[model samples]
Target: MISAQNIIKTYGNKTKKTQILNNISLTIADRSFTVILGASGSGKSTLLNILSGLERPDSGSIRYADTDITFLSDSQLTEFRKEKIGFVFQQYYLLPNMTAEQNIRMGADLAGNPDYRETIRAVGLENERKKYPDELSGGEQQRVSIARALAKKPDFLFLDEPTGALDEKTGRQILAYIADIHQRCGVTMILVTHNQNIAEMADTVIRMNSGRIETEQKNQTKKTAYEIAW
Candidate 1:
């Protein structure tokens, strides 16, 4: 489990401070699918960054199981993220020259998972493994991004607007793959998105407003990606 206590974050200097997160505290259960929902500048993304160990909180404590991650040094945090966290973003951050197989393999190397090809197949990239980023469609590229992250087999998978750039049908297809990965791998998945429809598929839904959590509730019956109302 990941726990945050009295989390607070800010930007800019002391004289011109802008609060991003305010005394946010929550617990993300292992293997649970959590969606962080909010509008622009609502601190949802900032909170995800902190939870994923990419950014630090100004005044708070974050614990991953028994370890206090809030106190870890930069290098230690980097190592922690490298070993335990995987990320997918709205933008496919694939290397321009690398094949899909090579890009996914790079993530696999971190965890020494040589059979990452299965992940490629999982995302329906078997035929496109030899293709480069430019050779694939927007949805295919995002699938490659997901496959790359899944290749690591991280304990936690963080996605920020994974389908924001795709068409409706393509977005649904990509989301289906993500949901499939979650079911098969049972990884702790956290997604940050502005779409209310996507929250129907989440085990836990957290809504943020103006740097604070507006509400958080557990879904008694989570819907599938196909069932989501777009």
Candidate 2:
């Protein structure tokens, strides 16, 4: 569902010209789970931001299904982003004032999508419905953030180190929950992480370096060891 070709991104003034991404190319299938693996400053987050339509490349093209988003207008891109993509960042960007359930409900409310009560249940947040962000644990807060993203019911889900802020055990729990959702919801997911073990659970693993795709691995996807012990 995602296709990117010969992408080049640069920052700083022309006189300085620090090249951040170098001729990156990639293709991802419909409903396929892909894990993007890279070390720090390897352009994983930049690629994700571009793919999610938050930013555009200077050259090359990005095609998500029928549209080449690189060429879309600002208004069009905003509409597409609201309707077709959901993001889970390293930091749980939940609003502190809103209750957990209310925070998620707001995403759907903004999109005019279906009510997300079921999605809240899917994220295991039904029990912590009325709690505010500060009232929840780190793991619980992250679960609420995930629920908020899924509540939009976007066509694609982009996760940028979704477990980066949590402890190892909590991270594992979150990753398992994410893997379970990938299998059960059939939500096309692209997970960006530095952990090789987490990449093993994906249908496709994309390794990138210096803003370009280094290599990719396709696995039998149907066989996964992650059981929903959460």
Top TM-score: which candidate number? 1
Q: In model 1, what is the error at residue 38, expressed in angstroms?
A: 0.5
Report every candidate's CA lDDT: 0.93, 0.86
Q: Encode model 2's per-residue lDDT on 51-136: one tens digit a residue.
A: 89988888989998889998899999999999989899888889989999899999888788677898888888888989999999
Provide TM-scores for the models. 0.97, 0.93
Quote model 2's TM-score.
0.93
Most accurate candidate by lDDT = 1
Q: What are the runs in model 1 whose C-alpha is more than 4 Å off? A: none
lDDT of 2 at 113: 66
**Alpha-carbon error at 68 in model 1, in Å?**
1.3
